[model samples]
Target: MASTLYKWAGLLFLSSFPYIFTLRGDFVFDDTEAIVKNKDVSSESWTDCFYNDFWGTNIKSNLSHKSYRPFTILTFRLNYIMNNRQLSALSFKTTNLFCHILSTVLVWFTYKIVVNIQHLKKHKIDISYFGALLFAVHPIHIEAISGIVGRADLLCGTTFFLAFICYDKAINSQKHSSLFMVVTIILSAVSMLFKENGVTVLGFCLFYDMIHNIKNKKETQIYKFCNKINMKRITILMLSIVFLLYGRWAIMGGTKPEFKATDNPAAFADSFTKVVTHSYIHFLNSLLFVWPQWLCYDWSMGCVPLIQKFLDHRILCPLLMYLYGIFIIRAIFCKQNKKFTKRILLLSVALIILPFLPAANIFYPVGFVIAERVLYIPSAGYCLMISFGLNKIITRFNKYKLGLIAYIILLLIYGLRSWQRSYDWQSEYQLFVNGMLVCPLNAKIHYNIAKVSDARNKTDVALASYKEAIRLYPEYYQAMNNLANLLKNQKKYQDAEYYLRSALKYKQDYPAVWMNLGIVLASTKRLKESEQAYKIALQYRKNYPDCYYNIGNLYLEMKKSENALDNWLKAINFNRKHELAWTNMIALLDNTEQLDRALQLIPNALSELPNSPLINFAVGNIYGKMDRFEEAEKHFLKAISLFDRKVQAIHYANLGVLYHRWKRYDMAEIMYKNALKINPDFKTAIRNLISLQKYKNR
Candidate 1:
């Protein structure tokens, strides 16, 4: 008992040691949309997860990605709640590491069951221990472990192994068969709810039962198969599967997810190209298990070119993979081999092939070309096969020391690689830059690079990366939209307009692009065109507060103060904490001399945005306009203290004006000089300082 406990402790240490560096890593890639920006997982009601997609959009909405993993989102919400409703990447990643350790232990137990079923004699090298150890430290699992959003795969794998174990117990046990079957059904359902591909575990359970029956009875006749199996339990399992399928379909509103050609280009290609390319992808996925050296965050947008011709050299890879598969199948069913060997080979192949079929792009199209996280479960099969082969080399060739050395070396190399990969996930910039190195031609990688660069205010680097992304994939509407936003910021309205229109040519229903186009049109003084663009954007996404805020600005330019106020009110109704909308409304009211109404709105705005420096600044300006000097001074100081990074020069200049109006000449001069220190060329501060000096001289 003590030895077994030590073995599991060792497995836990091996699984978590390589990933300790990732505890400090920030949320990168899909973690932004799925965790940080996802209201379903952050501030929304817990039950909302069941009604929304993984990214927080309603599952029935046309814009939904239809990834209904509520169970996984619930885990994210729990993490958020545990961290006091703040985004703690450390807490989230630590939970992911713990779940991964749980999965590693589950793999160990499942492999032990499979080995015991084969009735193999105990040997010096424990296949279950080594197989699970290999799985724990495999470098290919880094993507699933380091990325916070990859908890879906980790949770699904845990429940998948648990479900399979329950099914095995149900079939073999005499006294507790009914209880075990009930547990199996619940686990299977829980597994599928965690991830879409987890339903394949039921298929694995059925395959295992069939193989177990065949091995025991030595049955060769196909007609006797159904009689040998427990029909009542099989019927219940099939019914449960049918019900689960119905539930999944209903949750998606019976509408398939929409994907563009860039997401999975092969799915939209001609039949020959699709077939040839998908097979090549299968070959590539297999290679990742054998040699997981080339890893990237994304594999789309021409990362693997479509095989258009029969003569294409990549086509040879699929042919070789198929031949190898055939060889394995023959070995599994060969009468010349011992029964134990046949059983081991058969179960290993089932483990490899069954769980992977959902991601094979056979029944339906997926949104990615290749995802490393999907290999987390299938790697168990690969580990088992390799561990068995190593045992064979030691026993058959009598090279025990050499075989053990090779096993240790393999673990060391993979563990070091996993440790190195964790650093790439430290920030979005590092992660996307590493992805670019692995897949330079992949336009999605370039687009991500541009996004991270734009966030850091590196405009030149951002522009170059965006152009490269657009050059690589001309129909990349997302890249075009983002590049147009950067150009708009640089005041190149004409260039921005061109890219926004070009993006609309490809994706007309994109509300974000429409909103950005409206902003560009507004900058160029095309008020009517801008209003039309804003309306179009609202038609697609009715709850978009940013669109309403922009439309309010447009109405202000058109001299429609009432209309501007109404739009700003709508913006606040949709998003109560929209600081820009609240501030703009206060400014408009002050301009129109509606000081009393603006003051009345301040309490509500402060309640929603208690620490918003912009709202506080607006409050100070309103108080100053109303001649409440003491209140104005208090609000201004609070605003300056609450400034996120740096207080703007205009804030200080406005406070200087307040001091000047209150007849505090010395304090007014200090405020003006502070503003000038922050921005030497600030015109408002220079003019204010000149006027204050004249007053002091008088």
Candidate 2:
């Protein structure tokens, strides 16, 4: 027990070293939208944070969209609260290091369980420790462990490993089989909450069981395979029913919401041909974890080929085909190997290949087929096979000398790669910049880097980057919209209008681009054109508060008071805390002498944004207009105290007037002087000072 504890501690300490240097990293690409800038989780209402409509909501939208991974959500929330409303990038990042350590421990435990499995035919493949070491230090896992929010991937992976171990325990009849089953189900559910791929655990477990059955049975082999086929069919039926029920809740409940082929990979000779080609590519990527030269977060869209060109060069496909044929023949004829050994080989292949089928570009081609995270579950099989292989090789050789040398070299290489890769994941910006260096023409890399630049106010650089992204992949609509935004910033109204139109052309229903285009038109004095853009935007996204807010502003500028009021009301209805709409409504009410209604709204605005300088300033102005001099003075003083001096000059001058009215001449003098200190040419302060001197003489 002590030795096991020491191993766990030792692994965690080694895993955590790279994180010490990564703490000060900035928020990466999705982290901005999902965590830092997402206001829903920022709100006091946790339920609202989870249930928020995914459409226009910021980080809160991440919950309901893309499989609603609540584990990631909970992680972010915990960090947010622990940081005491001032979450530094470091504080958020530390969590990922701890999660990675946890995942590594799980990986160790998983290997140990697989090694101890009674069905294993291989004798003492002592390389299990080396395989675990390789997995622990593999560079491919950097993407899952380095990014602060990527704890989701590690969380999913950790639970996935645990669930697999639980299945093995249940299969071995560890006396708590039913308890293990329940634990497996719950962990698998949590895995889904971490990522959509978590749903594959159940399928993988069944495949493992089937492989075992296939290997063990000789007399009943045909009947067993046939019965299992029917069982697979029934399982599919049951899962379909469950998905339909979940779909009803998901589809209606959404609060928000490639072609490849090297020379006919499909038209290849047969199923053998397709599987060989796909598996070759899959195995190559899986192999990269051992010897990762080119690391990338995304290999999608541009430059990179569908499959590595080397597979064809080496005639690997034919060789793999030959091996597969031999395996089939052995299953049929050769009765030499132990059942356990055969089962291990069969199950290992099944685990590695089965989970990947859904994403293997057969039924549908997901842009790029290669990714490290996609290998998360599949890597287990590879690690096990390697460990077993090691155990076999060591028994026939000098166990200590050769084994130690080989292990050291492999660990050194993988560990060095992992350490270097971890630096790239320090922040989204670093990741993208490094990824581009690795795969320069990857459009997503350029797009993501451009997004980070745009957020940091590096608009010119961002524009060029976005254009380059568009040049690389013209169909990238998100880049098109971002490029339009940059064009708008340059005040190239017509140019901005053209790019916005192009974005709409590519994907006509992109409401954010429509809203942006409307903003450009409104600024250029094209109110009618702007209104049309906003209406079209609203048609596509009825609850888009930003569109409603922009449309309201357009109506206000065009002197359509009633229409402006209607749209502002709609904006406020969509986002209750939309400060602009609230402020606008209060101003409109004050202008039209609806003082009582306007007065009532001050409290509402205050409730929305407590201690807000803008709200306080607005309240002060309202109170001054109503001739509530002392009340106005108090609020104006508060506003001036809270707000920046440059912006709160009017409030200071107003306070001077209130003091002068109450016969507080000495205090009025000080207030007027302070106002002039803020703005030298302050007309209000000048006039108020003259009035204060006259009042003193009287």
Candidate 3:
């Protein structure tokens, strides 16, 4: 027990040492979806925590990513809470580190229990320790452990390991107790909340127990003990699997559409040959365990070629892995004499294969052809294979010194590589730049870099990357859409129109593409085509608020006041927190002298978006117009208190208007000057100050 503790302590330190560089890491890629932009993770109320989908609010059309991972998302919410409701990469990365450490420790604990239960011999070599070390330094797991968004894999892995350990305890415990069994059942169910891959924990446990049952005779106490409880265990395991299937199927409805072709290789495989090709490539990628180097963040489309021949060179290694897996299966269920070596091999394969079953596109699309993070749980098998298989060969020659030296050298190389990779993960820009070097032809990497550049207002870099993305994959509608948006922002309406048309040529059904096309058309004064485009967007997607909002602007420009108000109100109904819709609707209400209705809507809008100073400011102006001085004063003060930028000069200017109405000309003058002080170039403040001078002269 003391030695086990010492080993785990050392392994924990070893596993975490290289990741210290990631302490300063920024959230990248899916972190944008999973944490930074996921409103559920940043919500103050627990109702939002439980009720919201994985992507947070469903205001935007994200059917492709309709996920129910409340448990995993809660972890992200906890990090948000710790960071004071602000999205901080440090807080998320810290939680990831914590999960990694816990998982590493659990790996050691679970491996020991499995070996002990299997009645495997404990010699000078502890296979479990070696397995744990190999797992720790395996560079394939870098994406899962180092990337903050990959916490789904980490949380799933941690829960799966605990469930496995609990299963072993339940089956092997001398006292007849279903307590451990019940815990195993609950843990298995809980694991799925973290990730869908987690459901395989039941299979891993049941299969391991089945193999152990084969090894132990009926007369043995171990076999007899389990025989009595095994039926109960099986029942519980079956129930868990049933619940998982029902939840995913019933809750999510059915298979999600692939919004992007690269989301799932198998799903995107429009032909049988394509499916076989992608399947083989996926298997070969995982076979990287045998040669654990040349790790990549993203593999370009067509990088993995089709397996045309029966015995193709590209798929040879993958074929061998399949044959070995067969051998391991044969060894486990062979009725005659079962070898301990074969049992270990089978168990190792179980560790690797079971967790990956969910990602087998045969089940459904899992939103990636191959991601290194999904290999985190499966990499445990690689560790076990090395410990049990390679360790035996080394000990046979009694070359402990040689094996030790080789192990140290290999870990040093891997550790250094991992350290270098950690730096790539330390910044969002660095990851994309590194991804660019590793897979320059990867359209998604370039697209992601372009998005980050657009966010930072680096228009040239964004344009270049977006163009490169389009160059690599001409059918990339997202790149086309984004590039058009950039061009639209620059008032390159012709270029914007061309790109939006190109995007429509590829993905005509995509409402956002149509919406952008409408805006570009409107900017170019093609009012008829613009209206058609907006109507087409609304026709394709009924709940499109952006289309409604844009059409409102078009109507307002055409002096169709009633139509404009109707469209803006529809936009607000679709997305109550939409600032433009709120602004437009309240403006129309104020213009029509429906001040009471505007005041009533402010509370509902406030409820939807508590922190929106614009809503408060708008309400304040309405109250001032209604002659409710106290209420107007309160809201104006609230808006001013929340102001964090010189761009908020309008709020102070509104205060000037309020004070002027209240017959405090001197106070109004002070407010106008303060507004001018904040933003010297603010024309509204300049006009307000001119009005103040007129009042003073009078």
TM-score of each: 0.94, 0.75, 0.79
Candidate 1: misplaced stretches above 4 Å? 1-6, 218-229, 539-541, 680-698
Local accuracy of candidate 1 as per-residue lDDT tens digits, 178-201? 999899888888988889878878
Ranking by lDDT: 1, 3, 2
Considering TM-score, which of the candidate structures 2 and 3 is the better prediction for this target? Answer: 3
lDDT of 2 at 52: 41
Q: How close is each model in CA RMSD to the real structure?
A: 2.7, 6.6, 5.4
| lDDT tens readout by residue for model 3, 512-576 | 98888888888888888988999999999999888899999888777887888889889889987
> Worst 10-residue stretch by lDDT in candidate 2?
256-265
Poorest 10 consecutive residues by lDDT, candidate 1: 219-228
Give the poorly placed runs of model 3, Cα more than 4 Å off.
1-5, 21-27, 35-70, 73-92, 114-122, 147-149, 177-183, 217-260, 266-272, 290-338, 362-366, 584-698
Q: Candidate 1 at 126: error in angstroms? A: 0.8
lDDT by residue for model 2 over 369-486, one digit each (tens)?
4666666656666666666666656766748567667766876777777777777777777788888987787777888889988988988779888999988777777888888778
- Stronger candidate by TM-score (1 vs 3): 1
For candidate 3, give the lDDT of residue 668: 83
Clashes of each: 0, 9, 0
Please tell me which predicted candidate would have the highest TM-score against the true structure: 1
Top-down TM-score ranking: 1, 3, 2
Between which residue pairs do clashes occur in model 1? none
